[model samples]
Target: MTTHFWLNETRPARQAGAPENRVYVRQYGNGRAILLAVHGFGRSGARMERLGLQLGDQFTTLAPDLPYHGKTEWYDDRYTPREFSRILQQLLDRYPDRPVFLMGHSLGGRYLSSCLAGLEHPDLRDLVLVAPDGAGGRYTNWIDTLPSMLVRPLARISERPRSILRLSGWLSKRGIINRYSAEYLKSNLNDRPFRRRIAGTLRSVLKFPPRAEAFERALQRHAMVCTVFVGDRDPLLHHDRLQSIYGPLPSVALHHYSGSHWLPERLLGEYYRNSLLTTVP
Candidate 1:
């Protein structure tokens, strides 16, 4: 049997082995405020590069790759809140008085919220969410249910998802899973790198249960304003569903726009690509 312990500031001083995390953060912009952006599932920190540019140079955007994505490395089985805070703590430490903003797209919202559940930071001024996931709507995954014994094996299968895509399709056809789940799985499964992303983070992400309450609490505790953007035609997280989760919260404002699930990619991608092309000599 093995036991592990975490040493915090309040605890008695003792020698303990701390795991080091190599987080790859892509910095963009050179603004006064700090905007810490998180990308969606299966994507690296580069996914938010365009977003930083779109927001102009008023924010120092720090986009970091989570486990199983980009250049970041994570060996621990669990992606704890302490780890999340430690990764972003560098920026917070450097600019103690700077106002901070958080932006997340798709699954990035869930990942960010989960990691924030264990943190306390009043410096967080606002949260900008684009088509956020895990807000208790149509953004449910069908492959989440399985016996405890099969969880490990199922995670392995996701590494090479070609074999199980058919099963996902079958479930979608029968109305067992939503349209977004089927489309999302089919589109990314064929790509080996995306599959690796899914496999590396699936087990840890599945452990992240719904955290709407925790998110609301964080916003209230920090007195941070939240802006939620939802696509009217988005199959995954539509406007109505998002309102249901954020409507009652005093700090949250829900806004709807005309688009689909890939709204961010459609807009941000185009702008960033053009920006890059024009800047090239």
Candidate 2:
């Protein structure tokens, strides 16, 4: 069955000097409960529309295209958690009186984690992370080692030597790297503007990596409920790693599923019903 919802196609004007983020929001229902859904890297809010629709009975879901993806425009070449946090704050301001329950996947989850660590928002009620990236792991450790100052310059350099990106694709074809990894590398290399945006994003994240201790502190400070879902075979993050990183936190609960980086639609629907619905009331 086809569902009807409102789509705001206009690009909203952002403050001067800040990144121009034209948020394309897909709204479902007008329920009393508020929900803000964020999508992963390389994905748009349109991806989260299904999950939002599934939970329409319980919430008014606001899924917006994040900066640099989908219909959103990012005029500033630099992207950092602080800048992204400001964008989030603007979105939150739209619903000043309501507490928002946040659900994010992959990169989206990382953004939420960063916000919880550094920003203070009294209206943020709870959090749900699906295969989140900012949590401690080998990937995060590698990110921690990089110098943020060098990232943008390196991105520029890589653009000139297009061979580097082509070589990455060749390596993927030769089975040196997994197909998923290879495609991701090639996509960035082919798109110069996106590559620069990605560089800025990485630079910001590396400059201010999320601290597990800080996440715990924030959760305690806000008395927020957090639920984490991890796929057992997720190429990006494994369930075991999630356990090691977030297991000790009293406010966070972890659930494992038999899937990969992307959970089955049935499982995702059930998650919304079981986790979000139960938490709201």
Candidate 3:
């Protein structure tokens, strides 16, 4: 049987009260270890599927669509912490004995950090962050850290064309958001439906600030093997920012690529080592 393929699925919530917990995942491969891959902002699970495809020989990748971006249904007033935990549990529960690895890209890094903050699975062995967020990057701004009551109104700023354009422009000018993010916002807010979708993603982003200290502490507690892959020219993911987040732990490897925000997939393949994996944690 060919284990190297892709599968798209939307699994329903098992718990009766958790109807909002349905999750959509794009899975690839059937290797011994399981990889839970998270994608960047303004992207679906398909983006992470690209990286997962490269590591499929050694790892089976489970990339889930974050709420507001894909098939996942979420229209809540707030995107609470551990919001996806149940769905994650549902996915990983199938492979009880497999050593699980975590990988996140850009904004997905923050989601990964939030996931690890309370997840207690010992089989989790490694974390691969590619141009990830929550490394003390520019995104942890006051606007995003607002109280829940205030955040809904803040996210609604994206509802109107003028307000969102001005906001993105202001964020770019203040360096609170990346150039790509600013550009994406400017170009995509024309349609009302897309604007609504953008509002929800913005709300989710606002709800989860940088959990760096919490994430780092969790990594130490779990003794997780961590490797951060960054592009040298990626303005959003700088060397100093990453060093600040992972420098205390000498075990963490920081690999810098000679490129831009989009890392070369071939280089990522070069660094994947199954030797680093232990027997189910």
On TM-score, the candidate that comes out on top is 3
Off by over 4 Å in 2: 1-21, 117-123, 136-141, 161-163, 166-179, 238-240, 263-265, 275-281
lDDT of 2 by residue, 42-148 (tens): 68777866666676676678777766677776565446666666666666767777767888788788778878765556667778888887673333444455465
Please give, for residues 1-281, the per-residue lDDT of candidate 3 as tens digits: 12222222234455566645345777776668778888776677776565667777777878887776776656453465566555566666777777887777777777777777667675777888888776644443435544678667757887888987987788678876777768877788897656877677667765566656676688888888678887878766556867776777655778777877664667765655543443434
Ranking by TM-score: 3, 2, 1
- Candidate lDDT values, in order: 0.65, 0.66, 0.68
Q: Using Cα atoms with residue i matched to residue i, what is each candidate's TM-score against the true structure?
A: 0.75, 0.78, 0.81
lDDT order of candidates, top first: 3, 2, 1
**In model 3, what lDDT does residue 139 have?**
44
Q: Give the C-alpha miss distance for residue 240 in model 2, angstroms.
A: 4.2
Cand. 3 Cα-lDDT: 0.68
Query: Judged by lDDT against the true structure, how good is candidate 2?
Result: 0.66
1 or 3, greater by TM-score? 3
lDDT of 3 at 6: 23
- What is candidate 2's CA lDDT for residue 142? 42
